[model samples]
Target chain A: MPSLKTLIPAIAASVLLAGTATAGDLVSYKVVDYGIPSSLTGKAGDAAAGEKTFVNRKLGNCLACHQVTKLSAHPFHGEIGPSLDGVAERYEEPQLRLQVVNAKEINPDTIMPAFYRTEGLHRVLKNFKGKPVLTAEQVEDVVAYLKTLK
Target chain B: MKTNWNRITLIAAACAVCVGVFATSANATDWGPYQVDDRRSGYTYMTDESRAMQVDSFQNPGMIWVEQGADLWNETNGKAGKSCASCHGDATESMKGVAARYPVYDEKAKKLQNVETRINTCLEKNMQAEPYKWESKEMLSMTTFINNQSLGMPVDVKIDGAAAEWYEKGKAFYYERRGQLDMACKHCHEDNAGGIIRANTLSQGQANGFPTYRLKWQKVGSLHRRFRGCNKQVRSAPFGNGSDEYLALELYVKWRGRGLPVETPAVRN
Candidate 1:
């Protein structure tokens, strides 16, 4: 077993991390730097699960505003945003993740919604306050799926 | 003539200074001709098949509401035993060009009032009847009846002096973002006028076809009724029909369709 001196620091570190989550104030999200994070919550996301989220209208619904020609069955994909068929070849993984997390950080007027940010939004219902449109895990999953588009 | 143009420019520039113009207001005030009189029937982005139905008077579904309106126009309903026809003789003559100048500034009321208000005023004062509820079928029938007389006439609402303040308010309202969707009216109607969102193709959202027939509702509806529907789509709470906000919006959008012909009982998706 670990000694008391070592256990004290370990317990404090876990408590600090736990407090960051628990749906804290959305203002805290400003700490999410403009560029990429070193890792996506330190989890290895399943690509298969991420692909399902990409196509589901209730989830990511990216297909609503973009055309991904790779999905043969999805018809009449929107032409508003550019096609994302070979996006992985055009952008690095970190850049793609930034755009997915919050495109408005780059272009303030882009109609593309911020899928994983939790600040400066209107009418986020009571139960959903401080909650990003998708959870942190979902964001990681989507990023993994997007990296496969090449 | 040069002096008249200069005077108008002075008024417009003054308006800009007073109101602090919004960015989306420019798009609301400046748009080229929307394709009308063709298959699209003013809503240029809707399907050609829907447009075909609007042009064919016999097959036009809105004609049913027009026919219903015609019946209500001549019927007696108030406590005074008076009908719209009792004082205003033949509608074909008395109501000509009336709908074209609607949402006028009422001097006594000190506010902007549209055709719906005018109809209700007559309903209560002239006929001594209870005022019709907003968006009610009876109100729609009367409004459609009166406006149908001005069919094919170009929209020519006069927006000068007192009307100018309301017009600016309407423009501001058009560009203001609301609801969880955070969408301004100009985004869908003005910016993406020809773009497809989901199954429907967006149009310039002109009000010339109001008291329009929408297949979605399978009924004739007022412009304010459509306003409520649009607000709900954006997840915003809509105010009461004929509310000041909606009336101001009506005036502004009417100016947007300035030269377009009125197509009351206009068929829409």
Candidate 2:
């Protein structure tokens, strides 16, 4: 059995880790030439789950400003942003990853929200202050889903 | 996977009851920072049933509070022993065209003031009465009653003079990115008006129908209240009601509908 001193530190370390997770601390990555060339979770995402997030209003809500021709059964795709049809054919996976993570990096004037960024935002509500709108895994999932457009 | 898609489609259909997918007027008119020529009131975006309620005075829920305001206008309750009616006389004659041009830059206050702020100013300075709370039933009733007098009149507010600086600030506020969403007012209301966001149809977000009876709230609410709600929805800490930010925004938004007729106590979903 471990000593109390050792046990206490172990418990404290886990508590600290849990707090960080709950606060939605971002998984850091490097952007090389406007693209993140790594998997956020170091594993491939499920394209099927990504499709659900694309449509869920309370989730990614990409359909709010994007149109996916394959998802036409879902009504009222917005026209403000360009349509997402054949997007994968135009860009590779790394570029898609960066776009989902933070489109503002590519286009400063773009109205698209940074789904995986938390810093430098204004007047964020108390509960949402440190949290990115989508989790890093969700961002990967969205990128994975975007790849299926081809 | 197929079942999940089916469920989402079902939910989308349910939302359609409140959100009509019809396109807005095709005429594109150029306005400051916007090219939407199809200026339709928020009323144009509401469901048919909600619009019907606004047309029938008997069935309109907001008329209930307006009737109460008629009584409050006459009952004297202040150190001055005066009522809004005592000085303004019959609101029908004294208040017409007043609400239509409000959120006006008050030279005395040195700031813009909406009908709610104006009402509170009167109660404190003129009547020597405790001002009504910003969202109180009495305040909503009074503003609704006052604005009803100006119903169908064009919204005509001045942005020239000292008001011009504040108008610029309000315009900046409308375009600046805000909250966790990083969206400006223009993202939805300007760029995507008449488009669906989930199940809700985005309107031009005009200020014509204010102190409106919203089915979502199940009661009449002031424009400031709606502003706070929109801020919160974008995951931003909302400014307080009657704050300078909202007062300036009111001026800017009311100016956006400069030619649309006022639809006070308007019904909305």
Model 2 ranges off by over 4 Å: A1-25, A32-34, A67-90, B1-38
Worst lDDT window (10 residues) for model 1 chain B? B31-40
Over B1-269, each residue of candidate 1 has an lDDT whose tens digit, in order, gives 35798889999999887676554553452213343332123455556687688768898888887778789889998899988899998998998787778889989779898998988888888899999898787888778888889987878887898989999999998987655445678877776676666556677788989899898988889999898888766556676898888889999999887777787878899
Write down the TM-score of every candidate: 0.78, 0.80
For each candidate, report what fraction of the true interface contacts it reproduces: 0.14, 0.69
lDDT of 1 at B94: 92
Model 2 achieves a DockQ score of 0.41
fnat, candidate 1?
A: 0.14
Second chain of candidate 1: TM-score? 0.83
lDDT of 2 at A47: 94
TM-score for chain A of every candidate model? 0.74, 0.82
